[model samples]
Target: MKTVGLALAVTLLATVHVVAGDTRFERSLRNLDPSARLEQICDYTAMLRIRASTPFRPDRAVGSASSPAKAASNMLVANGAAFRSRKKWYRLSYTCKTTPDRMKVLAFDYKTGPEIPEEKWNTYGLWR
Candidate 1:
């Protein structure tokens, strides 16, 4: 019975992995020119927020984003799922730049909502 249970668990895990294939957002992030480096910068929760949100096209961004000079060159953008926590709607924006060396995060901006305003994110953005 123990062996059977273990096998079933493994099979379920594998099935989950296969079912959750790379999403478009996942693919874009993975295929970054210089490859993004996010481990040291972001914690598990932050990463989770970004991963939970995907296919961050401009239209779905909810707010306007203006790239800052500080955001390295060749920037790529993606947004995470929008969620409501404690009566507040929140969203995550992952912006990174691919330099000749490696992709580095320019900003991970968390925008607050009820009514998200359209503004230059790099200039007036909040970071987590």
Candidate 2:
């Protein structure tokens, strides 16, 4: 009976931790900058990790059809999802970039396969 009680307590603790983490993620999304510029948007550098849910595909057609700059601009306007590591929970940041030519939004994963070195992510729009 004692062992069972102990196990139950551990399970409850784990569940609480998971719920708290999720809450933090939601809060982060709410805190994202709604008016950040494309250049200043992806300028995040830290031991942080981000998780994006939306599909991310390079706008090759746009790049070929227009100029490289224009294609990059279109990519940033697409909608997507993103997750970042924070003190207590992962912060979620969503981006939606709209310009006269195009609009896009997306979620991004900063802590993907390999650690992306701290560098300037110069582009013309927002990323999730």
Candidate 3:
């Protein structure tokens, strides 16, 4: 019984690790085209502040019957970033996909503004 319990615990931990791994996410971000609009505001050369939220259900697929089906365990969410401007700070959101193999950004919209009080921008050390 003890051996069975130990095996189950190890299996559970391995499952959790596989589900949470996100190695490809940053890799995708690094592969973004330099001329892309996203590059204009956020300086990838400098350190960035990223805040990832809880995993959420991704939107259901539309008309593409030929595409591979996504697993129910795969989760997606929008992650926040704090970046430095000339002398100011700004925020943007990057859409990310979390799968057993890796996590990567699917697509991201344009950067936003100076950020608000509730955003806790200072926590990211953007003010410096």
Off by over 4 Å in 1: 1-11, 18-20, 23-71, 74-128
Q: Write the residue-wise lDDT of candidate 3 on 1-128 in tens digits.
A: 99999999999999888556433435565465532313321222112223222122212111111222222333222234444434444444433333333333233333343433534544554343
Write the residue-wise lDDT of candidate 2 on 106-126 in tens digits. Answer: 443232222112231113122
Superposition error at 12 for model 1 (Å): 3.4
Residue 124 displacement (Å), model 1: 15
Off by over 4 Å in 3: 1-76, 98-100, 115-121
lDDT sort, best first: 1, 3, 2
User: Among all windows of ten consecutive residues in candidate 3, which has the lowest summed lDDT?
Assistant: 56-65
Candidate RMSDs in order: 9.4, 12.0, 15.9
TM-score (all chains, Cα) for each model: 0.27, 0.30, 0.28
Stretches of model 2 off by over 4 angstroms after superposition: 34-128
* Candidate ranking (TM-score, best to worst): 2, 3, 1
Task: In model 2, state the lDDT of residue 40.
Answer: 26
